[model samples]
Every structure is written in structure tokens, then in C-alpha cells.
Target chain A: MAPPEKIELKKQAQQLIEQYDNFLFDCDGVIWLDEKLIPGVLETIEHLESQGKRFAFVTNNSSKSRDTYIEKFHRLGFKGIGKHLIYPTCYAAASYLKEHLKVPAGAKVWVLGDHGIETELKELGYIPVGGSDPRLDDEFHPQHDLLKVDPDVRAVVVGSTKAFNYMRIATTLQYLLHENKSLPFIGTNIDRSYPGPEGLILPAGGSVVNYMSYTSNRDFIDVGKPSKRLLETILEQRDFDKSKTLMIGDTMYTDIKFGNDGQLGGESGGSLLVLSGGTKLKDLHHLIENPASLQDGPSLIPLKYIESFGHIIHLLSN
Target chain B: MAPPEKIELKKQAQQLIEQYDNFLFDCDGVIWLDEKLIPGVLETIEHLESQGKRFAFVTNNSSKSRDTYIEKFHRLGFKGIGKHLIYPTCYAAASYLKEHLKVPAGAKVWVLGDHGIETELKELGYIPVGGSDPRLDDEFHPQHDLLKVDPDVRAVVVGSTKAFNYMRIATTLQYLLHENKSLPFIGTNIDRSYPGPEGLILPAGGSVVNYMSYTSNRDFIDVGKPSKRLLETILEQRDFDKSKTLMIGDTMYTDIKFGNDGQLGGESGGSLLVLSGGTKLKDLHHLIENPASLQDGPSLIPLKYIESFGHIIHLLSN
Candidate 1:
């Protein structure tokens, strides 16, 4: 199939900005990749701010904390992004465990991800252990000092990490299986790969957990976007009129598929797909032809094209 | 609080033996602990053999392969226990994934339990990885391998394992959370604890998954005895008359609770609770008075009690 005709997604987004009171923007490929901001992204935000639009950066990446993301945005010239920047990882994990596994507040846990997951678990009264500051010296190594699994450790939560190793993961599995077989093994997300500076790279938390499951013959539960848990968290947080609110994302699998359906965010919510990242233009042709391929149809046809946020600002001003 | 005045569980078993043509026995605390046979268990088996009664060993411990359990039994002095030794772990895992998760048979999986889980996953066409002989200087750490999380890996199947570690568990969580968030995480059992030679140890497979969940902040889909998945597997296995087949176990949680009217197993079958393990005599009084404590309720009761296999044989012979 031919690639989707470029139809100016930014222009359409600009038009929508005029109509809508609030704007939800995705992070990762939409704003920046690694340390560099996407061209025109800052200008788009600046334009939106000047026009009095309420915007929230909604991200599925659960590895880094909001503080980390905010700091990264600041470094990239995003001026006023704050804690309100929403992430689905920690919220998803906490809600999934609480509702499905009935993990009570104050439950003990062995965490292998970042502050996002640890902080969320703590808020739910979960006792988190093993997680360390990634910026600290060699904190990611699963050696003797970091290798021990507490007998009382009730669960193991996996998220994203920069310094993951086979030894550390194996040690955690050994303790979980041999020491506390009754405890749960949970993962915060399941994005198979993530965008890295070099290109798409191994997903930190979800991929590692998947591998451990293969070797150990165990199963893990995921709590991030596209999962019902994450959608529920979004609903709880937004509490907006479902009929009016729209979930806009770039990926077909995580964003569009998880939104709009009662399966995740309830029946009233709507999902809009954008053509900036993940879901390439070629994939849309395949999805359009195959009904089953798109588990749930998108509420609105994805804006076909966008070169940069600058175009969005230009379209809005015009 | 006192133990029920020495009810002759042996006498009741003898009467049942005289009344029925077939007899079923539960493994675990009734017949053995780990590799060691339970006390006086052989004598009862011999007596049952002498009485020419048709019997089979039924178990919910799905961690060990049938051959392994049979071999253990033979080494412990009970010879010729046939391949009909029933295990619920593998069947439960497979059926639940097939029906609920709808995982294709060809999906790759990281299995972290025993041969039973591995063999079953293989039969379902799931790619199984990991495991090595402890004696072979090879380090017996298949779970530590990083390749288990290959992009092709679709699910994590957890069961029971003796060599599970923290690193292995943490890695598995990472993969599930970041790399393959869509991949299913399944657990074969959810028993919080199990009997060990030293008394009660961690219930290996499901128990490990449970603990990891607490730490990891994830949830798991469990498929084992007492779970609805087990009964569904059993019903799918054969078209036996549910009314005629009796479910017997030494534990109230898995065994008795699986009787017809129980939560998961439904109301077409009967259950017999043995007192040799799991539930104590005092617990029965508590259950009888506080019906809510019994998850399956009045439908589950001790149909017959036997001190040991010896008593079962004695009853049959008389």
C-alpha cells in the first residue's frame, strides 16, 4: 500500500486547539527524542501558552519520574511543565495491584524500576525495596550488596532502568520463586521497544520481565497504558466529561486501541490518532483494510500529516 | 480449640472402601513431603494393593512432572504408581491462556517453574526456555540468560522453581513492563505458602509470582486448583460424569473447595477433605461455626477421613 498522503496534522491540531479548552500532548517522539527537543515543539507550546490553552504532557513511558521528565523538558527549553505532567506507569501499577491483586496498602515490595514506580507504590502504602537512584554510582548492579532478597519481601515490581543486568534479574527471580512463591511478580508496562538516541532500543522494564518469564517459566502482570489499569487511572485523574474529552496519541496499539472502549477507559471516551511517531503511515493502510487488525476503531480518522509543531502554530495563527 | 475427640477417620475410610469400587488419593502431605514419603504412607498403599482396590494419586501440585513424582514415589517405597497421577498446573495454565488471554499456540514464552509447566507449554506450542541440571557444573542458572526476552517472546509462564533468584525475577519484570507490555503474564497457582520438610516454606511457583507482584506492583492471572481455570481444564480434558467423579484432597483451600458447589469447581461434584495435612481438626469446628470462613461453604465437607493409607486399606479390606 502507498504511504498515507501527508495532510498537515499540525494544521488540524491547531484548529482543534481553537475549539478545545484543554490539550493533552504525548511525550517521547512527540516532544523530544533523548535530550534534544523536536523542532518547533517549544514554539508550539509557547504559542499554545500565549493563546491560553491548558496543556498536559501525557506519557506512557513509566521509567522516569515526573520530576525527571520535567527536568528533561526544562533542559530542552520547555518553560513551565510541572508535576501535573501525567505518566501512566506508576498510577497504572498502583491501581492494577489494588483492584486486581487486592494488594493492601503497606504491602512489602521489591522494586527494580525508577522513582516513578517506587513513589507510586509508596503512595499506595506498598513497602518498596531494592530500587536505587540510577544516577548514583553503580546502583544498578545486582551484586552481593544489592543481590539479597528480603524474606519478607511480598512482591517484585519491574519498570524501566538504565543499568539492568542478567545477574541482578536472575537474583531477583531466585528470591521470588524460592523464598516467597506466594508473592506476586508485576511489571508496570509492556511496550516492547522504546525510542532511544541511537534508534529503537530494548524496552527497559517490560522487556526484561518478559525475558525473565521465559527463563523462569513464570508470568507477570502489566499495569501501563493500553492496559485497563492505566485507562482507569487516567479516568480517575481527568474526571472530565467523557463525551467531550478526547485521548490523542501517535500509536495505534497503545493509544488509540486503549482509548474509546469500555474495556479500558469506558465506552464514552474517544481516541484520536496522530501521525507523528510509532504508527507509521504505511501501517494505517493495513489497519484500514483489516477490521480485526484494529481491535477497536479510532473515534476520528488520524490526522494524516505533520512536519513540526511550528506548522501547527502557523495554522492556528492564520 | 481442642482437637475433635479422635474421630476414627480410619473407620470412615474403611466404610467408604467397602462402598465404592474406585478410590482416589491426594499427594503432598498425604503421601509425601518433597522427596520423602509421609510417615506410615507405604503401609497404607500396600494394604490398598492387597485389597485389590482401584486407586489413583491426584494432586494439585503442578510444579513437578508426573514422571518426577512417580519416580519420587518409587524411591520412597511405593512402587508402580501409574501415569494416571493427575496434575492440575499445566492444564490450568494452558486452558486459561487459551480461553482468556487467547494467546496463540505458537507464541514464545519464558517458563519459570518445573518440567510440568515446561512440558505443558511446549505441548501448547509455546517456546520454552531455561533449565539445567544442578550437578552439571553449568551453574544451573538458565533464568539468568538475557536472550529469554527476545522480541519473539510473547508471554511469561510462572510455576514452581527451587533455584529462582532476585535477578531472574527483576529481569522478567523489566521485560514484561517495558519491552512486551502486551505479552501475557500468567501464574499457575496462587497458594500463599506450602508444606516443606522443615514445616511450611514458600509455595514455590504461584507463591513466588505473588510475592514479586507485591514488590513489582503488578497483577497476574492465576490458573490452578481452586481457581476457576482448573475446573474448566478438567471439564475440557474429559466428558466424565461430574456427579460420579469425587474430588479429594488433604487441603481445604484447593481440594475441598473444588467440590461441585465450590467457587470455581461448581456444584456437580463432591469433595472429601482429609485431615492428614493442611487443615487441622480444630479448623473444622471453626469452619462449621463460621461458614463465611469456608470460601466454598457447606457444599464442601469431609466426606471421609483416614489417618493414612493404612487406614484406607484397612477400611477397604474390612
Candidate 2:
């Protein structure tokens, strides 16, 4: 566990390009912050594309469907990014129901998120309920119809939503606690906060998921980043060798640990930290200083550090 | 060490009354379930009053102020229930700011709960903000003025609220994360759920507090039951001898642990669990069978068990 090597030299950037045949990118801080794209990120990705490096976009934000993300990517100047290349947690949750939990396509999936989850579930042939419902926007009442658990709901998916309220939480609790806590509880992510549009740190999807988990007094199946199942799915779907793949993102706990613990780069280590997003150089230094203070100490430590993934293009131009 | 003694016989009821000079009761389940009074509870309290026993009502609920509780008590058949004799967590939170944290009078306190916390803080010479404000009811927007923290607010108090929404949560998060999280963060209680009307269980104050804690990634000062500070304050305020007091509650984690950990009833052990609210007979059996399963296992186990606090009057009359 040496300190992460800073990718400042052009030689280092070239080595990074040659080190991996595939890349996994985290949205939000990594690719774009809100609606604004980071400088040179598009060029770096285009360079990778020109170099025949395979990649897919992975985001823990379950509020946007893959189709919505496609629009965002295209709007941000990303070209030829197909729906299959985007892996939002909304899609992961829906796919988890179908592939892992064996939930039938037509079964009802209770949602405590936004329209993204509802859209994904609908696209996957499952009926979505309790999400973005106008009724849940009403003030909480003891006898609200939604408070009663629908016997048809096969599982519960909790993610991020701007419409978080007591009605939704209380109703979701019924499903989570229904049948002696029998239903599968799926959480989209575990991110505490994210960089917001106004230079403000806003509560992220994990906070919402954790709130429900706390209220229900039960553990949830996290389908977001750092989850091995998600990593495995992405790797298998893209047909990329784990040893030759790299995870490039701004956050350490999710993206870095995801790459490191998944053995993404094999012995060379697969995770790279970028300062362009939520994490800064000081944050990396702090983690290196107090690695033992966190729960997953070593696994959270990234293999390398750089100013930003976009900095790679700047370095190559020099 | 052993199974809780069941207070069933008339002799047992009489002995219980003789054993304690003061009784601390948990209100939600022990006295009444919502607005409806638990059967025989008033008679039992009257019997204790006739025998010159003193008592105080303690509840984890922070939604209603002490004055509101007075109306509820009078609406039921209870007589002479004074405001000073109530120890709701709202009052505890306000008092903690004043006494423990040494926050100055007239200092602004940020609130993320209902009117109870605001009323209590205002009564204690503090200006309360952010709670029950109509603007917080608006849909969340990144550029909202409330997203900016007020430098004047000295602390943050979070508790239960049926009005919980993203606007309130997002606004409060600014205060909690303000000034490098330097402000004192006070949480009213830690009860996961309470028995609600219509035989339903509802999320409680702890869920809200925990949501903020998780979102902010900071711990809060819990001013509610099972906290030793709350017990000490009650004992000192009421001038009740620890050895002669009994804690009757519907919850094992909060009320029972409050009495047991505070060493109420001296070596005899102070807690008496009532199977009339949330905990059932089966729950107690499970706890007794597996003491090591919970975090605070031994302290949560009650010294005695009863059908209901009101059942004492029925037993004595027999």
C-alpha cells in the first residue's frame, strides 16, 4: 500500500492509455457535473474510442433511466453512445429483479424513487407502483390507500428522488416490513452526498436508501457501484477481461473500491482516482494517511491518482 | 438473568404498588394508544395517586408540545397532569441545548421537525427557524434561498415530522454541514417505530434523526429515552429516589433500558415491560432466548413483565 502514483507526466498518461483495453466511467463528478461537462473529458474519451478502447458509462444515480442518460450524453457531445453502453442503477435494479431474484416480468415492483426507476421497470415488462405517484405527494394520512401493502408487490426498490416525503417513506415501510420482512429490498446506491450545481453538497441516493433501511430495520441489497454483482455484470456484458480493464471515476469508495476489489487491473490494480469530480487531491492524501480509519480500509485505496481523467488529454497534447 | 416476573395476581399487584414511591410511565402504549385511553389505566393511576405515589409521563414522541399533551390528557379522563410532569423529547432537546450544550438564550436554533420542537425552543428563549415554515413545503430547487445556511443559527434539532419532504431535509442538511459541521446536532429520540392507530406500526423520530445523520455523515446528540442524561435530569427534577422509582414502558430498547441502565429500583432492577403497545409476549421470549443477538442485550431486558399497566387495577380489584 504505497501512496497512489500521480498521473501528471505525459508518459504516465500514455502508459495509462496502453495499460487497459477497456474503461468504466462514473457519471456525475467523473463525466459531467450536473448539466455541465468537464473540460477535455469528451476529447479523452474520443481518444480512447479512436484507440479502440472499449468502455461503458456506470452511474449510481437511479433517478435517470438509461434513455434519459443517452439524451444527456448526446447533449454533452458524447457521440455514438448507445443505450446498451449506459448502466444506470435504475436498469441494474430492474435487471436484478429479472436475472437474479427470478421475479416474473409482470410482477409488481414497489418503487420509492423517481420516474427513472418506474420507466426502467416498465421497459423491463414489470409494473411499477408508488413512485412519482401524485398521491404520494399529498400530506401523510394514517388511512392513505398506499399505506396498505399491495399483496402483488414482489420486491421493493429504493433510490434517489427529489419528491422524498413522509407519505412515500411510510408507505414504503409497509412493503419492506410486509409478510414478516419477506420481500427483497433493493437499494440503488450508498453515496452519502454528491457535488451539486450550486457548489453545495447535496444528499445522494444512499442517504434515501439508508433512511428507508433504518426505518424498516432491515438490510437492503445494494445494486450500485462497488457491488461485485454489478461489476461482474458490466464485465461480462462488455466481454472485457478483468485484468485489462480500468475504472476511472471521481469518487473513491464507489468507483475505486469497485475496480480494486473486483481485481479490475489484476496485479497492476484497476482503479484510478480523478480530482475532477467529488474527490480532490487533499482527499486522496487524507485517505492515504488514515486508511485504517474506514471500514474497508485497503480496498478503498485507489491504485493511482490524477488531476482529472480529462487531464489525460491535456497531458497528451503537451 | 432470568425471565421477567409476571404481575398477574392481586397480591403481586399490591406488592408492586408498595415497592415504588414513584412511577415513570411511557405514554404512547402504557397510558393510551393515540387518542383512545388504554382500559383501566386512569383507575390504576388514580389508585397510585390515592396511595400518594408520584409519577411523570415520558414519551419519545416529539411532535406535540407539552401544552398539546395537556389537552390530550384532559380530553381523556386524566386529572391534574401538569406541564412540568411531562418529559417529551422536544422539551428534552430544547433543555439539552440550554443546559448541556450551553447554547445562549435567544440564539437561533435550526429545526427539522414539527411544531413541538419549535414551540419548546421558543418557550426556552431561543428563536427557532426552518420548521413548519411554509416555504419549506415547496418543491426542492437548487437555487432556493433556504439552501443557504444562516450564520446566526447555533444548533440543529431533528425529530419526528409528518411533513418530512426533500425541501425540509435538503435545507436542514445545509445547517448540519455548515461550518465544517461545528454546530451541535441534537436528535430527539431513537425509537424506530411506534404503535399507531388502526393496528399499524408507523415510523418514528429516530428514523428522521438517522436520515439526517446518515446524509450528513455525522453523529447527533440523542436527547431521548435510554440516554443516561435524560434519566439523570428526570431524577434530579422530580426529586425521585433512584432506588424507589419504577419505569413502566411499552418499549424495551428505550424506556426499559432507561430504567435498567440508570439503576432504578436499586438492586431490584427498575424496568417493567407492558405487552400492550409494541412488544408482544413472543418478542420477550425471543430476547430472553438470545441475549447476545442485540447490541445492548442485557440492558434491554426488562426486570418484570405485565399484561398492561391498566391491568394492575383489574388484578387488584380481583
Candidate 1 lDDT by residue in tens digits, A126-226 = 88776664322232332445445567776777776644543345455555565435668787765555554544333435555554554444677766656
Which candidate number would show the highest lDDT if scored against the true structure?
Answer: 2
Best candidate, DockQ: 2
Question: iRMSD per model?
Answer: 10.5, 0.8
Q: What is the C-alpha lDDT profile of model 1 across B137-190, one tens digit per residue?
A: 233233444523577776777766654543445445555554435667777765
Error of 2 at B74 (Å): 1.2
Stretches > 4 Å off in candidate 2: none
Q: How high a TM-score does candidate 2 get? A: 0.98
- Which residue pairs overlap in candidate 2's backbone? none
Candidate 2, DockQ score (0 to 1)? 0.82
Candidate 1: stretches off by over 4 Å: A1-11, A26-47, A58-62, A74-80, A83-247, A250-271, A274-318, B1-10, B35-40, B60-63, B82-246, B250-270, B275-318
Distance from true location, Cα of B170 in model 1, Å:
12
Model 1 chain B scores worst on lDDT over the 10 consecutive residues at B131-140
